[model samples]
Target: MKLITEKAELFFDLMWSLQFFINTELKILTKIKNRKEYAALPQKDKQVVREKIYEQPELIDKYIASNPDRLNDNHLSIIKQWKNFIKGDFYIERYLKNHAIFVGDNNVYGVLGLHDAFDHLFPSNYLPIYVKTILLPFQGRIVYDGLMQVYQVSFGGGIKRSLSETYMQAKQNNKIITTLEKTRVKIESKAFVEVEQENIWTNEIEQLKSLSKKLKGGDGQPAINSPVFSLVKASIALADKALFDPSDIDALTKELQKVERAVRKVENTLDRML
Candidate 1:
């Protein structure tokens, strides 16, 4: 969805002021006499100035030092954060309720739209649209810098599915970047999740083993002493083994089928005994 209206206005005000400052400081564009003219310039012309600012990120510091607008510390802090900007080609993979998904070379960003929602800009069938843009931190969210260069390259079904998978992987791993400042926290959080997931599986397997041990046949004999309970114990053992290497899909499938068959045979055997 679009950014909050007031925030969007503040963004343009600060951004336009800074770009115009850069233009004059570097004389990148001579014709742009004022912020009004600079704002009205074509996206391509604005892109030229935008690239220059990024190329020399030190300009952001210079602008902060100048503080020509006499902006408050909070507002200047927002502008100073532009130094952490991420620039590259990204695929606009999908649009969700809160934010649209922008998948880059290695990071997925939850980017908010400016004046219009991303879905309104590009139809679902048109995605994953490839575009070159700059992702900046605004307030506490990620947003593009009001200019995008879209490529006309069309993707086939395979590439489309691959891009979709990339988005899903980032989501499942909790790796979708929401803020530029918390990037380090996100990486450490991902590692914690991975360890916790493995521990969950390990605990489940141990519980299963304990349950099997309590299912003794009789007179303190192991459950395997009885033909009927042997299948039940085997099923638990197979499940424990399967959990150890959950990533081996084919192997896990085979183990699961074996466990199902063994349990079914035990059910039938008990029916005959009764």
Candidate 2:
């Protein structure tokens, strides 16, 4: 069994904690949005309504305080704005009209988007379902995209690439473009993981070994022509890895056995469509 080092364990713990915080914040925002008072508030006054409805301002404060190094100028500005909104420091309509430029922006969403991408690539469930090798690069791409948004106000750029847009472009070109393409784009844009610039994509995948180390199980490979083939291959690769874990080997084996059955069922259904 490969023993998880203390540093690796700590890093994983931090990743989990960050994911939890992002989910909690998203829930709070959703709750505020669903409130009747939120709907009744004037368009400009909604920020105030959100502030009044959100119960845990301290959580936001704590996050900012703890992650000073992670925050950029845009993050600091948003934090200040949030603090002001929470304190009810300005007249609602006037403040809204004056700060109309910042009305729809929420830095928290960028953070949440980053975490969501991480979860998509490396699900926290017992049976993980994505290839670390393939997913890590995509994960980096997602982080880059999220950070761009988080610092968008302070850092002016014409436009940024979207994962969905990139996927579509790949499909149109009849290519199964993966992480290599994103890396090339990052290099061309001169944004190839500069941590000093608050880019988290740097070194995120350095520890990951190649997928070849874990791809020795199934005969059922996804069709390269499929638009979502990359994702499907990733999932299969993950299942394969889980089935062969050195420790608790049977635990993942049974879980992925179930997944294999499900995949077979789906394939049979698709076969009928032919």
Candidate 3:
């Protein structure tokens, strides 16, 4: 019955809403990848996560306002709950572990490496310039893309049919010229996965800010340490080291002990979060 657990649960609930949208996009993509059709999806893949970050309070309110006939009282109640939950302190990565979910480490890898999951089956090493530029954000620190890179070649011809050139990057990462725009095509390869990572990271950042707000009690007092924040920071760092620096196992092993100390420092608070 601790507020710590209550807060953590709220964070998880908000993240769950976003993660579900992400999973839905992945599922839909699995079935179809054609250009004309993908453009016509009811929900733009990135917008699903964007609404949670950008629209949030207003969007939820708008949904309730516009869909009076469909929403009813129960629907209104659910949206209220969601808003309140996010406004609280729940954290998805840490709290979910209490239930024996296989997250916080290797699981984080899969979620983080979603964008380049393609190169794993296709071995885009042939396009080093492309992959290097694209993978810059997440390359060494997170995900099993290096491991997946070896296996991309094994993907059957059918799986490799659609995006044989610049892959997913060329298809999605494009630019439209208009209104005095020069004839320049700076097609930056920003994939949907990149946006997803940013959303999750932003959510964690917001959680830290919320914890800071609460710990300071809105006064000028120094912010107290948030145990949930500590756990998340340490967990994310450890995940980065493990996946990115596999060769330096000894170094990571030593660092993990330090991370464990951090977790222990906030263990009691984390227990409450859980």
Candidate 4:
């Protein structure tokens, strides 16, 4: 096991303690029914509230309290599904593995979207479903042709879940498109910067070439001592100073793994953007 300095671990501890802050600050967006709607659905058809929904007992409740105006049918379906996910009312294990059951092998979108025509290329589509990818308590709507909403509606409860309009949610699709473009630009920039850093450091440490001018004692001679002599001395000192303990092979390996994971995320995001 590689040891981390106590100071270095402080941030990890701080972040861990505040892990739930995001969920607390941002209201969970979900649907709930009113007494009238509850009374309207025939008891035979309306699924009864079970011990499960009462379990987390709080996830759905919190979500509902945040979004009270969503009595519409589309809202109810997603709410039920969300409840099912939290309560494991349907597929608990599958959820742990897949997030959403109907989405057995899907993508999980915490605050992202596949809100596009090409979303079909996404594996398992995305979580929150392509249906409710947007529809947050504060946020307005999903984009694209509203095609995904129609597709989501066609699945179970028909047109009730479909939204008619697009581009209503601050035009987030536009933001995502812009972000993707920026990410691509960033990658290109990194490529050039990386090459430049390598070259600069190489010049800083490169060894001096052998004296081009032969020195003859008290005779005609080219300069033996020159600018390269200074560079060679600096390079030797730099190489020594930069050397650090390499005993923690495992630690170094882990750091490399982290870099690889970060790169992978960037690559995946770029792929999605593309």
Candidate 5:
């Protein structure tokens, strides 16, 4: 399965714009706070400036209202959604918690807003399995926070191929794929193999144990001690075979099952000794 489908590209675009807006807003706030005049002001004046720049809601509302032409309808809608959520105490707490998941040391509204935008655009259930498998393993890493970074690293930098070109190449030639895409493909292909091996190994081990218990002699020794020991050895061998030679798994699993059934039949006929 492909990692970045057409639907996924739409979500990526939405997230990229949301993150850009958030980053720009943060930079503007930082510039205001760090201005020489703001710093040189008296404590009373500085407090007033801080409250107006940082604490006041009217400033953001006015900015959004004035910037309608600069932002598309979708962007405006997202900004309004953010404004509404920030007003609620519970939403503020959850937003902070969500921000903590992807970023460290930079817990600003931008990062929180970026996360919220992603959650809005693509709910967890709606994300592609391959994309989830790729990103979930590296959630703590900075590069895992957004698709733009992943796209850059996966495709290379400095005059490298565009996303469209790379995506086309991925379709034609799997050899030049990104590490993340390669890993996703590998995981997708091996999932069934791993599951089948695990099921066979677990079932055989349980069956062997059950057969051993049923064949117990009155002297507290297993009645078919030699056969039980051989089956135990065979179980281990089958597990090793499944791990090393998966192509032969079905046949090996069937043989083990046949042996288990034979042992069960013999054990059921044997009477308890005095």
Candidate 6:
């Protein structure tokens, strides 16, 4: 969804005011004398200054050091946090009730829109929208710097499914980053624990899948056409489904029992062959 009205206004005030100060300090837009004048300029003109500001991110540090506007310590802290900003081309993958999914190079971010929700900005069919923008930490959440550059390239079904999978994986693993202040160690550690727990329960099914790969035979051998591999493959599929939705404990238990029986039959077959 969108940021709160007052918070969104504060974000604009701080962000634009800082950009205006950057323009004045660097003399990029010499004609713009004050904040009011800078605000009056078309978005295209402001975009030019925004690009230049990010080009030399050191301007952010300089602004923090100078504190030209005599902004409060809280405001300066918010500006200082800009050093941790993430600037990149991201896929605006999907929109959820809480935040929009921004899939970056190696991470997924749950980003809040400033004045409007991402769904309002880009139609559902247009997604996953490819865009270049900077993600900033604002009031303990992640928000993109007000400017965004969207690419017009269309995606085929394959690419769309891939993006959807990426979003689902991020959500399943709790890997969607919601704040810039979060440490990777913390996020990864939690994800690791959850994955490990899930893997423990499905370890036997996974081993069966691996063993089926080894049992695969080339050419027209009997092993190539064995029904055992089919059984293992189906078990693996059921295991995967159970992994994603393990709500019905009794159903999962019955599925695991069937898989265990299959595992025993495979083990007996291998014993006799050996």
Candidate 3 lDDT score relative to the true structure:
0.36
Residues 122-176, model 4: lDDT tens digits: 3442322333212111012111111122234223333213211121222332211
Where does candidate 1 stray beyond 4 Å?
Answer: 183-274
**Of the candidates shown, which would achieve the greatest TM-score relative to the real structure?**
1
Please give the TM-score that candidate 2 achieves against the real structure: 0.17
Candidate 4 lowest-lDDT run of ten: 86-95
> What residue pairs are clashing in model 6?
none
How far residue 198's Cα lies from its native spot in candidate 6, in Å, is 15
Query: Over the stretch 114-137, how does candidate 6's per-residue lDDT look in tens digits?
Result: 998888889776788899989998
What is candidate 3's lDDT per residue for 1-274, written digit by digit as tens?
Answer: 0124443343333333433433344453454444334434444453444345333445555555654335356535444333321111111111111120001111111112332333343333332211210110111121111111121223344533422332333223331111111111122223433543454455555555455444322255323355545556666666556544545878788778877877676665546655
Whose lDDT is higher: candidate 5's or candidate 6's?
6
Q: Rate the local accuracy (lDDT) of all candidates.
A: 0.83, 0.33, 0.36, 0.31, 0.38, 0.81
Give residue 199's lDDT in candidate 5 (0 to 100).
Answer: 59
Give per-residue lDDT, candidate 4, residue 258: 51
Q: All candidates' TM-scores?
A: 0.71, 0.17, 0.19, 0.17, 0.25, 0.69
Model 1: pairs clashing at backbone N, Cα or C within 3 Å: none
Q: Positional deviation of 25 in candidate 5, in angstroms?
A: 24
Output the worst ten-in-a-row residue range by lDDT, candidate 2: 91-100
Model 3: what TM-score? 0.19
> Which residue pairs clash within candidate 4?
none
In angstroms, the error of model 5 at 63 is 25
lDDT by residue for model 2 over 1-274, one digit each (tens)? 1112542343333333333344345553344432343434344433332333234556556656666336565544333233322111110010111111011111110111232333343233311111111011222221121111112121112222233344344344333222223445556346423432553432332223244334343366554223233334545545445434424656666666656665776676577668
